[model samples]
Target chain A: MRVQAAIEVAAPPETIWELVSDPARYLHFMSGITRWEIAGEHARGLGARYRTLMRVGSAEIGGLVEIVECDAPRDLAWTSISGIDQRGRWRLREIGPGHLGERTRVELRLQYGVAGAGILGWIAEQVAAPAVRKNLRRSLQELRRQVEHEQARAAAATRRAAARN
Target chain B: MQAQTARASSGDGHAADGDPFARDFDEHEAGERPPAQPRRGPLERLVDAAATVIRGRVPAADLDERDPDFIRESLPAQWLLASLWFRGEVRGLGHVPEHGPVLLVGNHSGGNMTPDTLVFTLAFSTYFGVERRFYQLAHNLVLSWPGLGFLRKYGIVAASPDNAERALSSGAAVLVYPGGDHEVHRPSWERNRVSFDGRRGFVRLALEHDVPIVPVVAIGGQETALFLSRGEGLARRLMLDRLLRVKVLPISIAAPWGLNVGDGLGHIPLPAKITIEVLPAIHLREQFGAQPDVDEVYAHVTATMQETLDALAAERRLPIVG
Candidate 1:
């Protein structure tokens, strides 16, 4: 099954990517994520691998995943190296202009299924879709909130610095 | 290992009390057992032959029979049952070693259906992908049951020390329930207890193999049915211990067959929410002396498991609703 959740953030794509690309920040924003740890040497870039787990229903489901596509400030995609077969992508686009001057549209897309699971697999996918989709949607909301909050803090800090100068 | 396997094969399932797998290990280990049974009638002889034939049908513990592909395919079905019906929640899986031969000792419950086994197997397989070699020791009768051969593909072998040694030697995590049939068929009132029935063979197995022991405690399986009694007296009177090596003829009030006897055919387990906690691994030599006393280790293991089971029991606001 495929699930996607999107949100508009006040910061630029670069700002959002900074949080999404880093494995360390997943627990801070990703809902239902129980674990996300670097499995190999590389921490970032296309070849980096991470051991990931999300609590859905009765199991902490996920496995080693490698970053397949890591385009800075725009897109990052990962595919499973083991465990449940899954492909995940983070898509970011710079929206023309909002009240906040510049905004980024961030979408988290995930497709997961057991390869030869047949009819029950189909049913399980459908039953689990809502929960997985909710987690993604909440994760994006949390990401947007964090990014926008940080931007507001920086702007305030800049205003105070200018006044002091 | 070969000698142990040979001795293990001598008795399919005829151990005395406190012996897991009903094997003759206790007789060999301690040299004390119940006296030999008297001469048998024609009916008793026939029953013994039938049981022998059934026991002969048990497949040899070939670790190669574990089919990773088959296990992967069947996981969805197990997931559905565990998620929707049992509402299984497994915690502390990280306590199991990342990769190695570890002994997972769990408390058995839910009688023949064994919902805990179903839930834990799914959790473990999903937690550590299907490629990892993992085996679970089951009662001889379960393996001998007709139409249940598919279980072997899931890496289930007959409960025997030699089989466990093979799985561990191959560096696969082996799961064993020291309680076996005795505790699994206990009365429901004692559901919250962790009763291994004074079995310490698991500790010896771990010490001999030099593997870490991880205690897996689970609750709510007993609520799956209204277990009335283990029927030890009845089984003894019927000579089932001699003929089939079955120590208990459990009686319970279960669905599809009220006042169910034997539970031989199994029954539909109630939708009881199962919660399993995997305790941190215990390195026997590290925790105890280099040459640990088997009795002391057994006591410590059972006590730790009992404490965990108590905590799990305390968390339940209701029985099956948990």
Candidate 2:
């Protein structure tokens, strides 16, 4: 069984991508991202995997999530390895200009599989899916608040700079 | 777009209560949506066309994006204006769009189901060059009211999947509440702890129909005419809430900032100028190409809503919080 959740945030792709592209800030936005760090083996790029721990309710699972694709300010995807099955990705698009010039639509998507190789597995997935879905949305909303707040700070700084000049 | 739709593998539409898409009330309620007027004589068609033209020309009230006037004309201004005492300041006239279909999805509020929406529409009509209809995708219960013929006429459509899909595809900017009514009724005022479910139908429609999604956040909406309790069990059963389609405070209850009953509408709040921050657009990933996985589609859209909301909130109390 696979579960997914998503929302549109109102910051430009560049503004949002700056935060998502960085491995340093993953936990700041995602609620269940227990452990995350750049793998010394490779830089953040295609095929580069980052080992991280995630929580599904009380249970914890650790996995090496590899970046299957990475198109800055556009698309990013990852799949879990050596842990509870899961795959997630974030994609940003220029939906067109938003209400004020500052907002852009960024869609973040998360998907996970229960690895139900049998009936017992299926039963476990039934119990776990809803909780994970809620977690995914909560995580995404956090990402939105973080990114937009960061951008607003930048915008305010820019205005202040102009004022000083 | 096809790829994006395929990627959105959300496991929704399963439960009766959980999935808005699968929210099938009953045959009687389902019959409440629209099928448009039936075929008519050439003169009748001409009359309809002329009416559309006239409504298009009339100065409209600034309503919420999903106010439903996208399909028909029912912008209720004189009524709400007469009811509430609005004396708030307006500063961002330069921000609203001058033309075209605009989506006005603001913070869900205490101004009844579509009161603030109607207020927004009225303001848009007053300020913008052309009077535009702000279509609001309201809950099914509000649109299902009778005295509210004013309801159907003003284009307040149900928030069901099918109705929302139809409204947007027909060229209207569909306004939605991922947080739904629950967000407005949050018990504490310490900033809502909420996120939208994996309902990507609106995002898919925006991609499929190719309309821009604007993020609107209105401050002071929930605080006004406030109804804060999340009534449970017996209090709810006899609270006259369901019949009203909105929660109401007890007759004797007072508000936080020292308010009492016996006021004009009881919960009718003191006049306040609601400032709305209409943030920039969330450009649908142009590459999604019309059909992408549902998961991917949902991801892209949800992120934008979250980001926009935060930006609006941060910008709400500008000029220093002294």
Model 1 DockQ, alpha carbons vs. true complex: 0.83
CAPRI grade of model 1: high
What lDDT tens digits, residue by residue, belong to model 1 across residues B1-322?
0000112334554322344532434434344346566986898788878878877887778899999989888888888999999999999999999999999999989988899999998999988989999999887777777888888899998777778878999999999887877889999999999887776778888998899999999999999999999999999888786666567899999988999999988899999999999999999999998999988998999999999999999899999999
Clashing pairs in 1: B15-B22
Q: Give each model a TM-score.
A: 0.94, 0.40
Best model number under lDDT: 1
Q: In angstroms, how far off is B175's CA in candidate 1?
A: 0.6
Model 2 DockQ reads 0.01
Interface RMSD of each: 0.8, 25.4
The best candidate in terms of DockQ? 1
